[model samples]
Target: MSARTVLLPALAVLLLFALAGSLLIGPAGLSTPEALLGLFGSERGPAARVMREIRLPRSLLGAMIGASLGLAGAALQGYLRNPLAEPGLIGVSGAAALGAVLTLYTGLSAAFSLALPLGGIAGAMAAVVLVQLLAGREAGTITLILAGVAVTAFAAALTSLALNLAPSPFAALEIVFWLLGSLSDRSMEHVWLAAPFMVLGWLLLASTGRALDALTLGEEAASSLGFRLPAIRLRLVLGTAFCVGAATAVAGAIGFVGLVVPHLLRPLVGHRPGALLPASALGGAVLLLLADLVVRAIPTAQELKLGVVTALIGAPFFFALVLRTRRETA
Candidate 1:
């Protein structure tokens, strides 16, 4: 059997085990039997309430958001034909965070529970438009990357300004913490709100698998294979916007899953970008779920932010990747 054939099943099984761990293990200290009973049984008790309301939503969001980030990263790297490419390379995450910050800054989030995420989604869509306008129609990869950098810088500056001008220290602290990212206190309402956009984005990204496979032969070769480059680019941008935007909206600015997962899993799939997509998604989900569990397990006065944990893990890996890439080129 080929490596991919083995890899996919292994990853899926790992994901299932991670999901179970997420549901069963928590600060509440429920036993395995009690957790299972709470989830499966219809008892109207505290265990059931914790199982269904708190852990379940947190687990589901972690899986979905992680999958979205992973899938988007694979798609972006494949489309750009650059190993360093990631979902945040196009400014979607920064813009989404800025949007969420704006909502918090203006007190809209306090007024409306969904305003924060809605603001984030809006910001992400706006970034797409700004990027397109800056890159112009028929722009190439280099041009698109440049435009994304510009937008990211602009959004980041504005976000900082919001922080500086925040009405109070508490408001500033709230913005800072939200930017740091966490999955605590999330609800099923968030899951329901973000699910449709993420599902649509996944379908769009998945459809490009064949096109990405062809593009590996060069854009000219992909064109000769009857893949419309313009159409492919459009789908990639929109799909990424949907996935990353919604994820940032719900989970804050969790990073590095996209950058790290595909690179780690690439060789196992024989470096086929098409096969990397699903594997990366599963890998991302597993990574985030495990990270969330770690956040709970750590004995601290306050829980560490999910984004902080990911960055702590991912930063070292990123430095190693940079050195390795440089050595390979040298």
Candidate 2:
């Protein structure tokens, strides 16, 4: 009956159709209509394997990674009260990439699949700790952004240096892909590999929903309302690092899902932090699944990376925000 009421449901329906298209449209298109029937067990075809093994897991992983990125981004933005805040900008992705790079390039992942995620989690944890030490309890927005910039720059530099110093061709290629982010040929092993950690990370982040809402006014106001600032800070940091780390372990460095999804869905959820989290997650899953489908459909002969597509879409959007801010300040 009204603008606010009509728009959200319309957007939701569109997102659902996009998701269905993602499951159906690909380089090897699934029977889709039949597969939808098969989902209800009314039909059978060659699509069963394609849908079950490849599309299903890829869709699931895309959803997982997208949700993780979206939640992390929303958490950072709410925690810092800055619209520009994203996990990648704050060194989470770089730290996670660095960790995975070390394990995979050093030949450790060959011996142990868990090594990749473990290394990423460790690197992310270390970076966050350093950020806490430098920024401290009295940090303002300027301090928070500055600390994140410094850590991200340092982690990126170190990652480049390691790639340059790599001992072999395999190491170099692995580093390149780690930075680019892909979902190609990813199997059930990867599904299981990152799922538990991703789920755990989501829980940790979701726990901070109330804290983020409390932070809207000011630290003093939030503290007066019985929110523990220190505990809030800890959960935000650990949850972001763990989830981002685990995601990079499997998906490499997919960008912009965190940056794009929350900003897009914030209005739909009435700007409520808890509602923002779930709305962003569903939106993110849909976004990444579609992007992965594009990567598959494009006739590159060689597959395109997921990050490349998302960054191309997101980079201009970010610059537009920057310009909008400058105009507003003026």
What is the TM-score (0 to 1) of candidate 2? 0.86
For model 1, how does the per-residue alpha-carbon lDDT over 161-219 read when each residue is reduced to its tens digit? Answer: 99999999999999999999899999999999999889988999999999999989998
- The CA lDDT of each predicted structure is 0.92, 0.77
lDDT of 2 by residue, 1-330 (tens): 765456556656756776677667776654667666544553455666667667667777787787788889888888887676787766767887888788876789789766776787777777788777766886355666677788888888888888888998778987897679987766677788778878888898899899889888887898899998777876777778777777776778888788888888787667766567766766777788778878888889668899898888889988987898899999
Listed in order, each prediction's TM-score against the native is: 0.98, 0.86
For candidate 1, the per-residue lDDT at 207 reads: 91
Clash count of each predicted structure:
0, 0
Worst 10 residues of 1 by lDDT: 131-140
